[model samples]
Target: MSDRVRLKGRFIKKKVRDKQVKAVAAMREAHLSKNVPRSPPNLKFSFDGRRIVDMQYLSEHLKCIKCKKDIFLRNTVEESRMGLNCILNISCEECSTLTRVHTGKMHGTGENKNRVDVNTKAVLGAVHSGIGETALNKLLVCLNVPPISANLYKRYEREIGPAIEAAAKDSCREAAKEEKQLVIANVDKLCQEM
Candidate 1:
């Protein structure tokens, strides 16, 4: 009887171990195949809490027109901000598509107030913080940074807003799923107290 019990215990332990190994293997496979959007780490440009964009911000943020892949930094040609009005030429590595993104232009005081050194990410961050476009421009100029035009700010917000919102929603859903068990337990405890 003792021998039989020991044999059964060993068998159960082996089975449990096998299941755990399988689960780990499956997780590794899923991680390898996960196709999350890849953003560059430690990107050089960021919102400084005062200005919306910076010089050379867009040069690091261009995507290939054909493949939609993030273009290599080396492929970006920094042009004359004054002469060309802040247009950057970028070549895509995957598809070799030459594309231009209007980053920002330097403007003389007498020149038309159209371009600022603001990038898309900075605009999005400002909008997310509930700051108005006009106020943001004012803040930038106050900080001695070039002011982004209202039209460009609005365009950036419109283009990138939905994607940001979607990502936020996904993050919230994931957080809620992780807390589901705790939430259920709390609800059950409340009901019992009631």
Candidate 2:
């Protein structure tokens, strides 16, 4: 046998190990490359209008006060319309009794009927829709409906504004906490890689 090696450099024993060493080094490189950092993909946002709840208002009209019979909403504009609020005159079919149902249910007892939540919600919706009392009044006027008095609108804002602000602050705090957790998780992953 003629031991003639051309690929290996001068060594104690002549050998051709070039191809084997190259293959081993390539495999090591391939294994180590799995831990390399990669660029993150860009995120996207999709926005839409606020959602509305499909409330079944017909259930609330059942059982009139005076006669305890089935009732229906009085559809007359004069009777139902009350600015942002309304009156649902649930008329008893049996006794013809007119049972008044406010836009919001009565909150308190005899003397202190302090606030109507429906009115507050209306004002809040108007504010969120990038409008205020004046704009609401204008819209109502254009629709040929009685406008909510400016003073009453202001009163609702005054009562519910603080609650809105508090809710916003809570939401912001929760978002920040979640962001911080995500950042910490990323940092931990990076440290583990190192």
Largest lDDT belongs to which candidate?
2
Off by over 4 Å in 2: 1-59, 62-64, 70-82, 88-98, 103-114, 186-194
True-structure lDDT of candidate 1? 0.60
Lowest lDDT 10-residue stretch of candidate 1:
44-53
lDDT for position 144 in model 2 = 60
Query: Model 2 residue 160 lDDT?
Result: 67
For candidate 1, write residues 1-194 as lDDT tens digits. 22222243454455666777799999998897544433323334332233223456565557777678887646654432321135556666665556676655443233334434345556777877889888886776777666666776776676667888999999999999979967786997878888
Q: What is each predicted model's overall lDDT from 0 to 1?
A: 0.60, 0.61
Off by over 4 Å in 1: 1-118
Pairs of residues at least 3 apart in sequence or in different chains that clash in candidate 2: none
Model 2 RMSD to the real structure? 35.1
lDDT of 2 by residue, 74-183 (tens): 32122343345565554455655556655444343354355655667778888779899989878767766567888888877776688889999999999999999998
